[model samples]
Target chain A: MRRLGDRVGMAWAWGSSLCLLLGLGTLLVVLVTRGAPAVGPGLLFGDTAPGDAVLGRAPVFDGIWPALMGTLALVALACLVAVPIGVASGIYLAEIAPRRRRALLDIGVDMLAGVPSVVMGLFGFGLILLMRRTLAPSATTGLWLSALCIALLVLPYLIRTTQTALDALPESLRLVGPGLGFTRWQNLRHVLLPAAGRGILGGVMLAVGRAAEDTAVIMLTGAVWNAGLPAGLGEKFEALSFRIYVLAAEYRDDMQLAQGFACAFALLLLTCGLLASAHLLQRSLERRWKA
Target chain B: MSPTSGRTRGERTAELLLAGAAAVSAAAVLGILVFLAILAAPAWQGAAHVFTWDWRPFHGHYGILPMVVGSLLLALTALLLALPVAIGIAAFAHGLGPRRLARIVLAAVHAMTGIPTIVYAFVSAMLLVPFVREVFVHGSGYSLLSAALVLSVLILPTIVLVVHAHWHSMGKELERTCAALGIPRGRAVLRVLLPLSRRGLLTAAVLGFARALGDTMIALLLSGNAAQVPGSALDGFRTLTAHIALVVATDTQDAAYASIFAAGLILLLVAAAASLTARRLGAGNGRTEAARAAPR
Candidate 1:
């Protein structure tokens, strides 16, 4: 009877695992079959918007170029803002902060990280409102505003990863700086940072993935359905994630729906590629460090 | 001879700048709270009407009870669907599968966590919603069950990774003990490991719940946005996140706009409560490695 019960339990576990793999397989298969046909060079770099039909004729081609560009620019801008502050904060927490202050900072980071993206959008909305009232009267939802909000959204990931990476380093590395009469800043710049560079890079990759895929924060900030192209930091821009949401929710034709699926596939590729690269980089770095 | 005398001015400035950077995290948290609070404060004037269940913005009613209930219900259903599969996958990686296959499964899960929520939302709206409607013949493919189905997939990575971490930290000891005592692997996992990781499982569930509740796109695209409590899994409903998005998109009127801030405040408070509960549970679990991984 005991043996039978154990067998049943083991079967259940195996069955569930198989269920998950099958589900994931179906998801990917659906995306590939539904999305692959729409993913041509025109979809990659063509300029015809989905709505740009001339005199009742369907548009010759449609592309997500502007949205792709907007996503890249948004993620790049967010990284510019977040990476420096996040790394510095991580270093401060790991190496310089007092015990009590470290605890306070950790709580703050965790709390901020836990805030929902929609709330971040709300926060960004309020910031724009405040700016309109006082600082910049022309302040509105746009690329820069979206980038700022995304920076805040991904900040905790960077801080956490960098702090953990620095914390994981050998204690003897710290001793070298003091033994060599190096100042704390000099020690970090010359020894500690170089040692932790790959780990910090890993965190940056994670932050980039996060900033690229966020839609809610950008949805309220500036991302739109049919922005031609971004001309300035303060202008509305298109993003793939936002496009996916709009197209899926409001598509008028099967063509547009297929476009949405193609966008989904492109985004999946971009994020998964980054993730896989990050994993490989981390592994190779670990192997090299061991050697 | 003092160390202070030997420090350069550059070093002092760098230290000051780094400390200022650290303070920015604290400042951002305070800023979000203060901004949301100041914006939401005006809704207090109409607090009585706003807290009720009716959410007819155009009719001058702005109650959010339905959205709140909808959000919680969606998350609860998603968690119920995901928790077992997540634990099973973790158990597979623990010892049920061959070593090579387990590593591949773990890596796949790690990659899945990085897939954007929008992809999941789009896929569900395109495929799963239709399937659910066809099979169940329910109200327009968009319903609580459809959203929750996709939501479970979205949060699966979070729960699976957490459970895997918990098992990684604890399963080794159980394995060694079982080996030494000649205990069967199935008995150790079934009777020993599952029961031991109760706190960890609770933490995973809470984290997954928070993630599902906070998601806007899935709720917006698939929940049908009916602004009523769902009578069944097939019923359409609104969630606080989706409500906030819809209000921002359509209603820029003063009362309607302020109502969203109130909704945002509620979502924030709920998320805070969830994370706090998870942290407490994790601390009780007494495994810092697993706890650190929980926030993902």
Candidate 2:
């Protein structure tokens, strides 16, 4: 009976694991099968022009150039806001924070990470409404508000990852730096950060991936639908994710809807590529550092 | 000595600046909570009408009871459906499989964590909605049941991974002692392993529940956009996250629009509480491990 039970349990475990893998694998297969046929230079470089009838047949002459540009703009802006603050806070918590405060701060950061994206959108919408009424009602201010909200959304993740990376470093590095007559700042800048830099970049890349896929926040503030291209930071520009949502949900034309799927596939490919490269880069760097 | 003193002064300044930045980041989180509270103040104070069952923002009714009901029900349903499957998988991975097979299984579970939530949402919208609509009940494709099922898939990775980690971390001595007493492997696992890992299991459940609750896109796309308390799993509903997305995304200017902020405040509070609990549980587990590791 004991032998039988062990056999049963093992079978169950393997079955469950395979189920999970299959489910996710099936999703990827479906996405690729449907999206791959539409991938071409025309799809990449063309604009969705009117008069196209069938799905994937429309004169979407321009690929996702504008949406890609907007995504880049949003991600760059978000990183600028989130990274320095997140890295600095991480440094403080790991290196210098008082014990009691560290616990409180850690809890706060965790909570921040767990806040739902829609709530962030709510916060962004509310903040923008206030800003529009009191400050500037222009699109630039809207972009700033949206960027700030996304930064807040990604900040906790960056801080947590950086802190973990910093914590994983050998204590001897700190000792050696200070013993060599280096100041704490010099020790951190020259020794600790460089050692943990790959991990930090990994975290940043993950955060950027997250920021790129965010639809709820951008939908509320940055969605411009057919507003063409953004004129400036204040102009309401649509992101690929938001555009995918809008196209899938609202578009009456099937070709446009297919174009939406193409956009989603493109976004997914972009993010996966970026993340894969970052992971590879980090691994190579770590290997070099070790050697 | 003078050089060391000068270096110390510079270090102190940098530390102060870093500390200040950390403080500001912490404050930014608090500021979001405060801002939500302030924005939702009118609704909470009953100065604004948020109890109406009607969801016509154009007509000035801002009752969010339906959205709240939909969100909670969908999350609960998802939890109920996913818990059994996730635990079953976790148990299998932890105790049932061959060592080589288990490693492969574990890797698959880890990979699931990296898949984006939107991808899951999109797949469900395209695949599950139509299937549910066709096979289960006619004209009922986008019901709460579909949303729950999709959400279950989305959070399955988190649940399975957490429980697996907890199970793997258990001391081998306990198992050996049980085996020496002629206890069957199944009984030993049921009686010893499950009980020891109860806290971790509960934490996993709570986290999964929170993830399901917090999910927006799946519910937005598949929950049929109906602002009603779902009478059955097959009935359509509008979740809080979905409603917030819809209201904010569509509403131009209205006091009724502030109700989205009210809903957000509720979600924030719930998420914060769950996060704090999970963290404490994790810290407690770490301490327990350390205590056990000490020469006992």
- Stretches off by above 4 angstroms in model 2 are A1-11, A47-62, A137-141, A272-291, B1-7, B168-191, B284-296
Query: How would you encode candidate 1's per-residue C-alpha lDDT over A32-127 as one tens digit per residue?
Result: 888877777567555553444222133233577777878998999999999999999989988899999987887777777778898998888888
Q: Write the per-residue lDDT of candidate 1 for residues B228-277, one digit (tens) a residue.
A: 99899899999999999988877457777777888998888877787777
Q: Candidate 2 residues A7-97, lDDT tens each?
A: 6655655666677778867877777776665576555446554334123344233455556656777888889999999889988988889
Checking candidate 1 for backbone clashes, the offending pairs are none
Q: Model 2, residue A29: what's the lDDT?
A: 78
Work out the TM-score per prediction.
Answer: 0.93, 0.88
**Cα shift from native, residue B195, model 1 (Å):** 1.2
Off by over 4 Å in 1: A45-61, A134-137, A285-291, B1-6, B284-296
Clashes of each: 0, 15
Q: What's the DockQ for every one of the candidates?
A: 0.59, 0.38
DockQ (0 to 1) for model 1 = 0.59
